[model samples]
Target chain A: MEKVVKILLADDDLEDRYIMQDAFSAINLAHVPFLVEDGEKVLEYLAQMHSDEGILPSLVVLDLNMPRLSGTQTLRELKNIEHYKDIPVIIFSSSLNVIEMHECRQLGALSYMVKPFTYEEYLLSAQHFYDFCLSKHSFPEFNSLINNFK
Target chain B: MQEITHISLDTDMDLVLVHKRTMKLGELAGLSLALQTTFATAVSEVARNVIEYGHDASLMLGIMADLKEPDKFLVATIKDHNNNLTDRINGGLVYARKLVDKFSMISTEAGVEIILHFKIPGSQKIISSRIEQWIISFNLEPPVSPYDEIKRKNKQLQELAEKLKESETQYKELTNSLPMIIFSMREDGELLYANSWLEEFTGETLLQLNVNKWANVMTPEDLAARWEQWYHHVAENKPLTQEIRLKNVLTNEYTWHQLSAFPLSDENGKTLYWTGFIVDIHARKVMEQTLKDNRELQEIKVQMEEKVRELKRSNLELEQFAYAASHDLQEPLRKIVFYSDYLYKNYSALIDERGQLYFNNMMGASQRMIQLIHDLLNFSRIYRDNLYLEKTDLNVIAAEAVNDLEIGINAKQAVIEIAHLPVMFIYPIQIRQLFQNLLSNAIKFSDEERIPHIKIYALNGGKEIQLIFEDNGVGFQEKHLDKMFSLFQRLHSREKYEGTGIGLAMCKKIADLHNGTITATSEPGTGARFIVTLPKEVVV
Candidate 1:
């Protein structure tokens, strides 16, 4: 059987969460992306998976503006964990600020994407995220793959 | 004895006249030139003695006949009433006695008298009648030779010389008493004379100053430049007036002084010497420098004020931009999210009836948002873009604006009356936008009861130009005039007049960019007039 590609997504806005779900569903991935309401829920889900000895998600998508443990803070805590350090993280934000994007990248985010205003653009961004999980390479090579999205 | 001529011994010139008379008498007597000189010399000595020691003195010269022998004597006798001559006559009498054939002196309580005799040679015989002729001839003598005239002139010149010396001493005293330094120098830069003031001020003697050429007393910083200027003036043979620093010996501090020198030239225009004076000018120079520095400081203060004003203006613009972004931009986004979520959750039910209305409302809000963003970008561009002013005709711009709004004008059947406008230096593109916005506003707000008549005209104020846009439109109340030009302030409801409400604000911004003002006056349901005043000449 093909290995299921598990993805975790975190966002604060309900509408943005719904749009991301639809975008992911349209791409026909091997498994559904696990959704969380905020950066704190992402951490709780990771802890539960670790305690239960479940498989770690291959990729984590985090929204920059979220309550309790923002995307950059979560990335820092995730990188500090020995087992979760290898999990690739991507930062999704509505702010088109290059400085915030650079800060997120410095905190171990593998890629940064501006949240698309339309469904079609979100669908395209979702395809790039799925491509990130499939392509196995060094962090630098993976970062360059989605660099044009910035 | 016979008297030929005599002069009173009152003055030294009288003594010279006495000598001349005696010489003439001796020449008339039959004495040789040697004898004449000898007898005149004896007579002058006794006469000088009588003049020195006597109150009234006179001399007599004549021939004396002796009955005992054939010898005839020429005699001279000096007499005075005052007998004070006895003590002073010894030396002059002894010398006279040796030069003459015979000499004698007698002093008495009444007066004193001196006598001298020279025997006339027998070959040059003299008679009583000849003595009368000799007296007449002596009276008629014009002058002995040029020597007499020269002797008289020499006496007058000596007296004049004495007067000149006295006046020169007075001049020296005057210069020494003056407060300033007065000096004279040779054309070659050697110091000739300096008044006592120079010595007192510098604590150096005139001799020392001459040797040093004022090098030690002058400030070193001013020395080289002063020398250069001095040489230039010397070369040009011109007067020099310059301010320089001089060290005061007592104070040991340098102070500003004005050194002025003029060349003392001869009739031939050759520079003989330079006479100069130095006066203190430190206080004046310091006051002038202070005034200049104060003026510069005032200029800097004005520039700083202008900078602060510009900063405040830009800060206000930034605040407005932030407000529009956070409020207007986010409003539509929130609505779109709300509507989309409702549709996604109730997709089957929303597709029946109310779903279309929700979609339409969402689309309208988004379109309005896009328009607001576009307008905000344009508004910000007015601040960001560099304004280029070019000389343009106002008539051409007005015509172009009308042409751009042709569709609107035809749809409303609006009539635009443009007066002949003057050419002006202005930002053509921005001014074009201003005209288009104003014309469009006038057309959009026209009264439906009346045909819209728009008049565009300009007036020439002396230092500024006034552009007027008058319209017969359904105008606003005067109370709302204050909010007319502010960003996003709508005077009418959105259903009545469709606008993002940035037109008048943009117009105000454009006016401010040109350093001009825009104001409007209106009465409810009547008409409106918008006036724009711009400087006749733009600075930048």
Candidate 2:
């Protein structure tokens, strides 16, 4: 049976979403990539999945800057929820300050990646995004990291 | 009398010669007429007396040459039938002597003989050729009874009084009726006369304004000055200009008045009076005082506003400083923490002990971050909290601080020398905390070669008590003295001098709350001396 790997992307840009969609199609991924426009939508998507399907996302991609709720806010809110709190939220942004990077980690974002200006960087990010979904998700180790943070 | 046609009498006559041409006594020729005029006026009084009492009296007349000088005299003879005529004739002779230069007379009860001489102004010879007779003498009756004497005295007195009244009326009209206070003061400040101006300004009548009564109306302040200025002005005969505050007689309200007076004097330049005119200026005086008070209040308000602006600017600077530290310095701290944790976690077996030590150093630097945050928070809290003041004894504070730090003091064998302290108004807990921090610094940063000898001495500087803390420690260079009181400002390595570098800075904040100053002095190897100057007169 084919693994229906679940993927989530929290970003506020329409053009970035369109470009990443094309890059993921090139990799021929079987899983569905869920794209939310803001941090609040990202939390809502995760909570809806826990309540309706009884399943958590394999991975989540977060953008640092958004209008009302940013990627850091999404990470903090997800860490507070009990059922979906252990899921890994990766940080992606156009401009990254080191303090913000550390702040994201402290707020429970698992990893960080710089979003480059060129289309080549977007394709590379898309390749890495497909690999992140395909790799078998580890629940025990990520759950323990969340436990240490608390 | 030869050919003398106006002859009326014979003087030393040879009566053997008579007038060849007789003339009436009332009609006479030129020179003779002139001579008769003189003769007539000369004896008119005698003639009136004679005609009224002893009528038809006569005198003998002649001319005689002086034997000694060039003057000549006319002689006249008068004889009257009255028995009292002889004495009267003698009186007439005295009258004739005054009229001419020389006179003589002899009289019997029947008639009198008088000699009157006429002399021209420059000629010595007598004018015997033109002699004439004009007057005669009579008896004078004695005065009447005592009642008649009184009546005559009364008539004279009435005439004298009429003259005095005329003069007084003229003076009164000349002095214009401005309800004058025409006063004459003696040189000794005695009021000689004061007029009705006092009665007009005050309700006092002229009779009530006697010297003693007017003196009673003077206010106590005026009496204290003794009217000395007015007295000197009048005494020296100078112009008087003075403003005096006096209470009105009827209203009892203080009225400021200005008196301008000129010295009145007689033609001989004597000081006769100080004639003054007064004008009320109470309203102007009040306005001037109000202007002065407003100016003082405005000055105080401007100073207060300036101090507030200064305080606002200082507060802005403190906020800016904290924000700048959080935003700019915080990024570097994140890099340190991130890299150190990365080196230890990802490459733990690959990195040797030296690299481990580097990571440890990075961690230590990151840990000083909390110190910076704490010091800034403490400074901000000082600005935010309400200051409570207390009467504090510095001696007790120092003793308690020494006892509390017995562990550190005994370990380093620290010798703490204290001095006499003053009782002053302060924040008691703040002062004790200040002592604890400073003593800890002295004990922590000690000399490697010797026991920490902390000498604390205080001296009263009249305005403030200056306390000096001297310690035999590994002192810093003088170049870093200014940075010693900055938050997290470290001059030495943590391996050498172990501290968060906030103790001295916190002590500085406490001193600032007391409106005091702290300064440090040190050499490379010699000990350090920290001087704290606190004002004794604290503003609570």
Candidate 3:
């Protein structure tokens, strides 16, 4: 019996979401990963925990900037909550500032990745993300950094 | 008593002495003297009151009995008069009230009746107030009557003194500062006093200006006659006006003096003094000549403008004529070149070597003449208009100019050094031409033994830009230094180096148009340096 590996992905644009979906199908991760339009819904699905019949995704991919709540804000808020605090949040943002990558990681982001400016680089970064989720690594084995609190 | 008295009435002459009973004699030996004065004063006032208010005045002289003792009698009675009396008879009544020990008054159809009793100690030297008031208030003392006229004269004399002091101070101030000679003389023409203005006008004081001593210094002419006429006026009390010719001791120039004199008199109607004033009218006469000079200067200014316009007009015509003449001349010179080449191609061996040499010389001279004409025209028209400025890189322009003449530069093996060329405000074409002409000349005139080396440097002087184009070439004699920028003034003959001799002249003109300066220094056979300084912002 093979266990179903669920993945949570958040982005703002519909066109990007569709293109990412097609890319996932091409990369053979379509069955394992699920998609949401923004970081807000990703947190909502995680909070339900059993709303989809007890399926808890092992991986969550986040975008840094979006309309309702920006990726940095969502990431900062999620790190504060205890139950969702350990969830792996990788910020895949459309900013190229090296300082921004350093800041996102400092804010307890599991990983910080810059969205590629060109089409070929975008496909390659997504493929690397697809391969990481399929490896089936245990979460507790990864590093945990506590974010700052005021 | 009913009036606010501005002038007292009763004391003006005398006071009333009224005795109603018989007199007490041997009152006191000294008391009668005092009482006598008192009684006289009172009686005089009573008489005066009688005259002023009643019709017929009378003196009242008697005695009065004391109220307690009939034997002790004092004098008391009204000075009687007969008429309808005025109410003003109270002047004497008031005198009697303050004087006697007991006094009373009653008015009747026979004037007013006043009664007074004078009582005092027998040893006393002072009389009672009744007697004292009667004597002094009525002016019975005779000496005080004479002082009235003296007081009036003293007041008049004081006012006259103050007025005379004020006028004297004003006269001193006016005379000392007046730009003339002022004097006062006796009516017979003897000088009395000279104002201190003589010190300023004649460089001599009043004492030095005595009439007898300085008569000749005052005027060379017959000024005695002038003084005679002036005296006639003072004697007749008429004004004197005249102009006398006087000589300046230093300049020896005779000057005309405007003289005016008038008579002054003492309190007596006799003429006592004559005052005169003299002013030099020479300077005022000289001012009239300056107006004529101003007119000539104005005429010269107009002529200068016309000359500048004529020069400008002729310059424009000359530039256009040069451009047109050169264009027409170049057409025929080109045809001559084409026909000579055509003849050489058609006839190969028809001419000797000498004929070929003659033809080459002809072509060479023709080409040289064309270049000379071109240069002559460029010099004539260099200052046609002001140089136009735009942002320019002199290095780039210099490089391009050097490249344009690079073939010649390489042919001469000349070493040119350029350093720190600025991005500046300049005319690209003109500057390029400037660099081309300068650089080419440096290469063309290289020393036969040494390689030609040229330096182009610029210095930034605030409000101006300066440049130096220096070269180690065959420089000429210093004797021709003054003519370096003159048109067609050349040191080297055409055989050695070909030039129209207008290059330096053109450089000078271009520099001037930009509100700049240019100069040259050279050593024979060594080199020449052309220094140019241009204002950073050309003055329009």
Candidate 4:
């Protein structure tokens, strides 16, 4: 029996979410990613899944800037919970700020990636997210991923 | 008794004359030299007592015969208006009584009288007429020896010395009572005398102060320089006037003092000594220092206000730039690019050739807008960003810039000649950006008739280094030099030259950030030389 790979993504922008979805589908990944609007919704979705005794998502992706709760605040809350602490999280942001990336890593993000602008770049980011979940490593290598963007 | 001579017993010099007249009487009375000395000594002692402790006193000398005996006597009588002779009779009077044959003192309501007699030989018959002759002979006698004149002068000198001593005591009291430090020093700067004020103020004696040349009472910080000036003044034999800080022993605090010294010279112009005074000027010095500090503070406050105004203006500009980039401009442009691409990809069958061409034009315009926004953001960030300086090789930065513009260089078939450049302390990223912009400009503005040629070299100008980028390209008129570095100031139209018009402005800003300058020399149709002068080492 093959286990299903489930992913959750949180973003405030509708267009960015749509593009992300389209990029995921274009890559022909086996599982559909669960999407939420902000960091608050991410916590709520996880709490509901825990209450219903449903399967938790395998990986979570977050946009750095959001309304109400930022990606850093959500990551801090998610890492504090016993059931969600083991789940891997990645931060995706439009800002190419090394300081923010380092801060996200310090806050227990498995990886940090820049938001892709083009369709081809989005496709590549989606593939990297899928591979990050499958590897199940504490820290993932991002050298090749960053080099491709350059 | 026959009175031979009489004299007023007034001053000490009168006592000397009394002794001389008594000796002459003894000689005239036929007394031996030994008896003459005894009788003179006895008479002079009584005279001295009258002068020292009596008022309205006189002395008379004569020859007398006692009624009870056949003996002649040389008698001297001393009288004073004071009747307190009993208390006035000191040891000299008792001694004088022993030297004479008879001595007696009587006190009356009118005055006091003292008489002395020395026995004379009867064989020396002196008649009344002979006594008159004796008196006349005494008056006719001159001073016998130089000893008399010398003795008189000595007495005068003693009186003068006494007067001088009294005046000196008065002056010393006056100096000691003064509030300031008064002192005298030797010509060689050794402390000679100081009044009570010196010890009262410094709590140090003249001996202790001279040990270190008053260093203990002075502030150590002001010592060396003050000493230098003092030595110079002494060497030049000039009056010294200086301000110094002196420490108070009780408070252990320093106060400013004005010290002045003048050399006391002799008639021959030889320095005798130096007279100096030290007066407190602490209050005046404090006020002057306070005024100076306040002036400096006022200047600093004005400078701070100017900086704040400049900061506010720049901050407002940054806010407007951010607002336009984030909301007014970039957001709509992003949507247009996104939607246009989506329509072109998903609905290509419904679009005619002209519609596709129009879509392409829209995409091109949006792309250029994105570049413009990005450049504007970079320009604003130059102010917002913290500068990080590192020692960087110019050759590496120039090579990287050439590599970054490789496609443009290939398209234009541009040739770049680079001379060896020095390593300098610089913001590496900004310098690389500057090199890239200049290289790209050289290639893009190449003349149609010639292949693009660029030469980059550095000239070391001691404190600064000038990096020159020479290009054989479509140059500009020299008159437009001021407008060239201004923001969005393009000399040519967009049809001929494709640009956001922020490249040279960004270059100028980068040069300013490094505390450097950027300028260019150009001819209208030939070539351009862009020069950037930068400090060899950046100060933090």
When superposed on Cα atoms, how far off is each prediction in RMSD? 21.6, 26.1, 27.7, 19.7
lDDT of 2 at A13: 78
Rank all candidate structures by their DockQ, best first, as comma-separated numbers: 4, 1, 2, 3
Interface RMSD of 4: 3.9
Q: Tell me how far candidate 4 lies from the true structure as C-alpha RMSD in angstroms.
A: 19.7
**Stretches > 4 Å off in candidate 3:** A1-150, B1-166, B177-194, B207-299, B345-348, B380-388
Segments in model 2 whose C-alpha atoms lie over 4 Å from true places: A1-46, A53-150, B1-259, B262-294, B313-317, B320-324, B344-381, B385-436, B453-502, B511-540
Q: Write out fnat for all predictions, comma-separated.
A: 0.00, 0.00, 0.00, 0.00
| TM-score list, all predictions | 0.38, 0.34, 0.48, 0.53
Clashing residue pairs in candidate 4 (N, C-alpha, C atoms within 3 angstroms): none
Off by over 4 Å in 4: A1-3, A26-31, A47-55, A79-88, A105-114, A118-124, A131-150, B1-313, B316-324, B327-332
Query: What is residue B49's positional error in candidate 1, in angstroms?
Result: 17
DockQ values, each candidate: 0.02, 0.01, 0.00, 0.22
Best candidate, DockQ: 4
Candidate 3 lDDT by residue in tens digits, B188-243: 66667777755554555455556454574556356677767665676568888886
Error of 2 at B151 (Å): 15
Docking class of 2: incorrect
What lDDT score is found at residue B164 in candidate 4? 97
Which of the two, 1 or 2, has more lDDT?
Answer: 1
Ranking by lDDT: 4, 1, 2, 3
RMSD of 3: 27.7
C-alpha lDDT score of every prediction, in listed order: 0.79, 0.64, 0.64, 0.83
Predicted candidate 4 versus true structure: per-residue lDDT over B1-540, tens digit per residue: 888877777788787788889888888888889999999999998888888888889988888854556788998999999887668566658889899999988889988888887899656666678888998886566655565555546756988999999999999999988778898988556889999888888889988988887788887768888888878898899999999888888888988999999999999999899999999899999999999999999999999999999997988687567744543465456666666777777887898999889888887888888778767866665642545798899999999899989999999899999999999999887898899999899998899889989999999999999999999998999999989999899999999999989899989988988989999999966989999999987664
Name the lDDT value of residue B200 in candidate 2: 55
Each candidate's clash count: 0, 28, 14, 0
